[model samples]
Target: MASTVVVIGGGYGGISVAKALDDIADVVLVEPRETFVHNVAALRAAVDPDWTERIFIPYDGLLTRGTVLRDSAVRVRPTAVELRSGTRIVADYIVLATGTRSPYPAKLDVEQAADGAAKLRATRAELARADRVLLLGAGPVGLEFAGEIKSAWPDKAVTVVDPAADLVSGRFPDEFRAELRRQLGELGVELVLGTSLRELPGTDPGRTGGFTVTTGSGVEITADIWFPCYGAAIDTDYLGPELRPARRADGRITVTTDLRLPGQHTVFAVGDVTALPELKMARAAQAHAQVVAENIRTLLQGGGTLASYRPEEDAIVLPLGPKGGVTYASEVGVLGAGPSADLKGGLFLDMYLELLGAVVAR
Candidate 1:
């Protein structure tokens, strides 16, 4: 009999490993969402309704032999998984890939694709009515949201306030930060870093209403709408006592270089849920999936050698709207707006659509 492999959470990493193992193992992928959310495009989706429809791809065509279970995992054991609906799945091997959760517009907080798309449309409508916007974080999501908003509505006043003292932290070079500030300045997006709001705005985020907020430094700012772009946490609360000890204080699961849980040979983890010292991005998740798949494949073949994963050099393809942004890699250092736009302008929707076997609409 073939080995039964159960993959929890059908996010980027989960789907990649499941598809890679479907032909060899009895792959079972469990996910809660009705459709795969291409959250990389979510920022643009909030500004353009056209992208909302394209970002949510159905899982029907993702696997030929593997099974995709539309259910949530309530608990995961060493060799089995218990679902919220009381179904227990026995497996020869298990993979944990439950990714992190971010604020809306960066990541839709809804389960169903239709509901998420509807929410984006409603938020877009609300955004259309606002003349001034306040974003409460200066991270990638916040900056990306500001860029998308400015791209859609250039005349609108967009201010990004963060308690962090620098843009994008000190991860990138000073040159990169300067270039980022330069672009934002050109787009008329204001940056108010090193300070936080004294209190949240009275109006709910994504809702259109006039509200005034004071910063920690006693700077008053008024905006017609606001959004929170921070506070992303990994989703791993369902691990049972047997496996819970492997989780770090930050909620990321500790895995070996081979991507398997230490001392638990048959259990593995990947993506943002892993305690890897790397940026939590979709590309990194997929890379983790590749290593996990290879290791599992070796084990299935009577275990010759296992593959290991190493953190890649810091790289980012951040897009400001569709035509502007920056790209940075260890090899290239940093490239200007033209390269960034060409690399991720369309948010790689077509590539992901092809990977999911969805027909790309022209």
Candidate 2:
């Protein structure tokens, strides 16, 4: 009998591994949503509500030989997964790829894609009506969101507040940070760093209203629209008690050198669910999927030396809207606008479609 591989969560990592092993094994992918949420374009989608539908790619075109279960995995054991519908599936190898969740409109709280689209449309309307926008976090999400708003509405006052004292990541070179600052200045964005908020705004994010909050530095900031842009909760509550210790202090699962759960070689974890030393980005997660896929393929072929995963030290590519952004890699120290745009502009949509084996209509 062929080895049955069951993969959970059809996000970037899950889908990538499943696609890699589709022809080699009986792959079963358990995912809740009917569509793959392309989180890379989420900020841009928020600014342009019409583009919301494009961010959600149907899972229908993903794997030709694999079966996708449009259901959530409520509990996962060493050898099987129990669905919320109470159905249990036994597999020879199980992959835990349930990623993390971020604040909307970067991520959707709704499980259904249609509902998610509706929420983005509503938020876009709110953004369109508001003249002043405040983003409460200076991480990639917050900075990119501020740029998105500025790109959509040039005159809108945008302020980014973060306790951290820097704009670009400190790990990157000074040239990278300098370029980031120049881009933000061109967009007319005011960044309030090294200062903590005394109290959070009473108004909910994405809602149009006047609100003022004082910073620890004795500066008062006000805006009509505000959003909380940082905070990612890993999705691992579905794992059984046996895997509890596998969950680390940082909320990510500890995987072996080969990306398998320690002691349980048949079970593996990937994406934001794993305690990878690297930054948790879709790019890194997909790389994890590649490594996991190779290991699983070896297991299916009856044992071979599994390849270990080593994260790239400075693999950070952030694109703010289609035109502006920054990128950093050791091979090429701190790339400029052209490189950033080339790396992560509208190309994401095309790349995903190709990955799904779908051809776009010209």
Candidate 3:
């Protein structure tokens, strides 16, 4: 009999490993969502209704021999998984890929694809009616959202406010930050850094209404709609007491160079949930998936050594909109707007669609 591998969560890393192991293992992918949300394209979907439907791809064709369980994990054991539906599945190996949760329009909180798309359409309508917009974060999410808004409605005023004095903190070079500001300025995006709102806006995010907010520096700003674009927390509550000890104070799970839990051979983790010292991006998550898949495949085949994953230098492919943005890689430093747009402007929607074998009517 083939080895049974139960993979938890259907995010970027989850889907990649599941697909890769389907041919070799009795892959059982457990997830609650009815479709795979291409969250990389979520910001564009919020501004363009055409992209709303394209981002949510059904998981029907992801596996031919494996099974896709429309359920969530309630608890995980060393060699078994307990589902919320009261079903217990025994496995030779297990993978935990539950990623992080971010603010709306970047990562939807809904489980079903239709519901998520409806929320995006509603938010798009709200954006269309609004004039001035206030985004509360200068991070990548906030900057990308501002870019999407400006691209869709260039005439509308878009302002981004963050408590950090600089954009994209960390090892990113100063040239990258300066170029990012240049592109955002070219798109007429206003930046209010080194300060934050005294309090949140009275109007709910993605809704249109007039509200004025004061900054910590005593600066007053008015806007029709406001969005909080920061804060992403790991999702790992399903880990039982046996596995819970592996989680750090920051909520990220600890894994070895081979991406396995400490002292465990059959259990592993990947993506943002792992305690890897790298930016929590989809590309990095997928890379983790590749490493984990290779190691598992070798173990199942009975004698090869497991592969190790090393954290790469900081890299980013931030697209401002369909026609603007910036790209950064440690090897090549930072590229200008043209390369950024060409690389991720369409948000890699087609690539994901093809990966899952999702067919959409053009």
| lDDT of candidate 1 over 20-41, digit per residue (tens) | 9999999999998999999999
Candidate 3 vs. true structure, TM-score: 0.98
lDDT to native, each model: 0.90, 0.86, 0.92
Off by over 4 Å in 1: 360-362
- lDDT for 276 (candidate 2): 73
Q: Model 2 — TM-score against the truth?
A: 0.97
Candidate 2 lDDT score at position 261: 90
lDDT of model 3 at position 117: 88
Off by over 4 Å in 3: none
**What's the lDDT of the predicted structure labeled candidate 1?**
0.90
Write the number of the candidate with greater lDDT, choosing between 2 and 3: 3
Which candidate number has the best lDDT?
Answer: 3
TM-score of each: 0.98, 0.97, 0.98
